[model samples]
Target: MTTDAETAVFEEHRPVLMGVAYRMLGRVADAEDVVQEAWLRWSAADRAGVREPPAYLVRITTRLAIDRLRQVKARGEAYVGPWLPEPYATDFGDTVPDTEERAVLADSVSLAVLVVLESLSPLERAVFVLREAFGYPYAEIATMLDRGEPAVRQLAGRARRHVDERRPRYDVDPAQRRDLTERFLAAAAEGDLAGLMDLLAPDVRLVGDSGGKAQAPLRILESADNVGRFLVAVGGKSVPDMSFRFLELNGGPAVLVLSGGMPDSVFQVDVSAGRISSVYVLRNPDKLRSLASA
Candidate 1:
């Protein structure tokens, strides 16, 4: 029974709601479900006196995401092999024009930061996402979480500290990252062990997430020697009707490997001090499903 005008209003803020939900849950399906639930609530609610639609929608999405995160934790499902956030395709296009704002959004959604966020409590993560990623004021966040301003501020501070201590520092220049990624890909595809080692930092670490459904390292592979050898070995083998496409994933360049036009895996790297520092390989088919159409 929702009017067209009201539906239009909800659609206008859908992107922001999706951003908040995805940042909170780190899973596309969960985030989408939370957003859909928010739509259901908005459609059925009394909207006559609602003054700020964006804030209201965001609040519903955030709360739902927090509840979903808590339920997921309670389930205690075991994830096989090392886990990484599902690669999120980020094409800001014309939506984010300000360089500083774009950088903030990208950093918040980066794989490294998301991995660090997984260690934070759901409440802390919610506060951090709202205050850091979206720049919501302490009072506004307090109202959203039904928490006092001081309590919200404390949560933000604690979450910020934890993230600062654990998050790996990577070069933010996209050009540098893109160049390094291209060279790394070339070296890896060519099975050039020396070239791969040269582009990798001495202490480079590679984390592969296969969810036990694909062939990937069960344990994290570390050091240039180990990582280089693994890549070389992997490259030496032939994938049937394999193809590669470059896309912007998680706010950075990623190589999507497809076998027979279906997503096989995604490879993204973090650059530090002009060298590849961390390599993230996502082979989880469930996680790659979204990228299949990209």
Candidate 2:
């Protein structure tokens, strides 16, 4: 392929490469950096011997992400407060034709699952993303990671079990989730404690990620009463100029709170049995910068 053709090939496979990178490292900027590095490598590598561009590109992207993830772990940077994955816009558009596959992909990228994935070893995380999220067979995944099939399968099993045990199961209905989110936000904003309590499950949990840079509960809030009371009290004290809007984020509907036209925070709920089971709040200023552009 000529230079132009090679560039086109990389661009053609960019989406898949990006998807792999983002799944591997929950941060958007990190994912983009890894993908860019992959492109640099791809552009300079010997393409004459490359027969499968997609597989080769994915391998590069995944490996780059793994390296980056390890570096992040090694840095041991102390986050300001509860950390939340940067709210990502994950609209797959019309490219993903299968509903079931899309749901699986969405769940794999969810904040809950991503948090659990953080506990996993880098290699296990890679295997889980490739095998569970992308449905790559063990043999193919082994080739991508330069590991034996048995080893890949073992990683997959261990990762899957870890995630399953940690991630709170939730219903995956988009329509239902959207509706519940809308109602939950309305109740909170209006300081309707009764309404908010009604929407919350008895054992609903609230996880706030203000990273100590902002005002949020440093500890997780459990039970409908505690979560509901905290939200109502906080909602009552919100700035007079505060406002909110709904948008699809991280594969589901989310409420982006704004104060004087600036991003204040993000509120996303996980629903189970038609009630809000858990609420994820992203309030760290660093995490909200992308919202300005998003």
Q: In lDDT terms, which candidate is top?
A: 1
TM-scores for the candidates? 0.99, 0.96
> Using alpha carbons, what is the TM-score of model 2?
0.96
lDDT of each residue in 62-94, candidate 2, tens digit only: 889999999999998887656778888888889
Write down the lDDT of every candidate, Cα atoms only: 0.94, 0.90
Q: What is the lDDT of residue 289 in candidate 2?
A: 86
Residue-wise lDDT of candidate 1 within 1-294, one digit each (tens)? Answer: 899999999999998898999889889988999999999999988898789888899989999999999999899889999989988989999999999999999999999999999999999999999999999999999999999999999999999999999998889899999999999999999999999989999999999999999999999999999999999999998989999999999899999999999999999999999999999999999999999889
Clashing pairs in 1: none
Clashing residue pairs for model 2: 80-211, 81-211, 81-212
Best-fitting candidate, scored by TM-score: 1
